[model samples]
Target: MGAGLAMQTAVNAKLRDFVLSPYLSSGFSFLMAWVFLLLLNLVTRQPLLISGTFITHNPSWLWLGGFFGAIALTGNVVLFQKIGSLQTTVLPIMGQIIMSILIDQFGLFQSPANPLTWAKGIGLVLIVSGVILSLGLFEPRDPLLKAAERHAGKGSQLFYQLFAILAGMLMAMQTAINGYLGTTLHSPIRASFISFTIGVLSLILVNLITHAHFSNIRLALKQGPRYWWIWIGGIIGALYVLCSSWLVPLIGTGQVVVLALFGQLVFSALVENFGLFASQVNRMTRAKIIGLVVMFVGVLTVKFITF
Candidate 1:
């Protein structure tokens, strides 16, 4: 899981390097994803297309999801660019676990998960505590304070942090909506394809209204043919998503999230600690190591309480 999440982060970082408009990144990715799936369909002699009714009959809440997704994807690219892969990867898992718990507990947006329990409830408290420790929120003297202020330029670091949180919340919403759609449509891949396709289309329409340059669109696609590996990320991303959908219905959404969180935390730590590929990850401090440990403990608490 950690490796996959790291790859996802790396994919976002690669997207950021191109410096295209946000909508273009998402739009091109969706197009690439569709093409990849089409190629798979041809190889297997199976039709993998979504129907028109799926789009037209979507609930208003799902439409709300498209709104969140547009912001989230754009924010993810920007955040990954701004903060590098490690913190961007770690912070969002914290946000997602908490948001998912609230949605599951309260039935917010009509999610289909069971209510929170004693173990899960304590798990929430542990998660909050863990995030605080992981972020070094209580440190008397933060090591990165001076450097962070110097490097962040113009906008506040708080803004970047908020963007990360918003991205995570939108991700949580996207996950819950996928679960609902899977239950309603009885097809995981179809649900994911439709949801992602609609979100990308909605973003593209917004860009059209804003008069974003057509050249950026072309430029984004041009890079795809030039760098096949980057475009391949979309294929792996789509497949991971499809498998996630299938797993959620069989194993439960919360369980799937817990596993994803564990995967992300571990991989993000390794990538950051070793500075693999000359990534922005700096020397690991004792506090950061402690933070990762706390976060993992919180995950264990979350899983144990539920079981």
Candidate 2:
């Protein structure tokens, strides 16, 4: 699922090229995923309408997963423009790890309570260190870091950074909430469809408010056939969402987040090394390899070690 997410990122980047607006591309992607899950639920004989009993009995927060997702998507775009991609990536990850830990420790969103242990603490540190190393952040002169530094005033930068962390926390909360929603609905597929539906509606509102060029949608359709691969971003994203909803209940949210992060980093390294999808070639360095090893160790520590 994490690898699929990385692919979705690449595919969405290409889709953004055709649509000429990230908001439009994201909304379109959500629309496609919504349609896909709608069909899946229909074929699987799942009820299209959510029962009133389920609605009346469940907490209202269960329904906010998609709204949170939409906000996170929008936040990423804004952060990408305001802060460099490096900070955009790292800050959210930090937020995700921290939030996931809190959720697991406190049994937030009705998730199972798994109090933090010493081994888990060590694993968290290693995982964070690995992320920093893999991104080459130890070098004070990294171009992306310098670019981010030049982009904002100190106060504004701190605000954007905090917003980025909040976005990440929202992402983790969304996963946990959706997992519970799936259990309540008795179908992860339906939960995914509903999530996408809400996300699409939210994005539609955002696009309208921002005056996003709807003309780009028509342009993208005309040019879409030439780059058929871009259309699959939504499908990939749908699967990722479905898997996250399904997995969270089975293996706590923290594990799901860590495992997915590991997959994302590993697959992203391969993508950069191979120069796939017209991405720039950045051959894997020793630091990246060492970081991967550390990340792997961290994953094991978190997953298998208890004492």
> Which candidate number would show the highest TM-score if scored against the true structure?
2
- Please report the TM-score between candidate 2 and the true structure: 0.83
Candidate 2 per-residue lDDT, tens place, 35-58, comes to: 999999889998888778888998
TM-scores, all models, native as reference: 0.80, 0.83
Q: 33 in model 2: Cα distance from truth in Å? A: 0.4
The per-model lDDT (C-alpha) reads 0.66, 0.76
TM-score, structure 1 vs. true: 0.80
Judging by lDDT against the true structure, name the best candidate.
Answer: 2
**lDDT, candidate 1, residue 187?**
64
**Model 2: how far residue 303 lies from native, Å:** 3.0
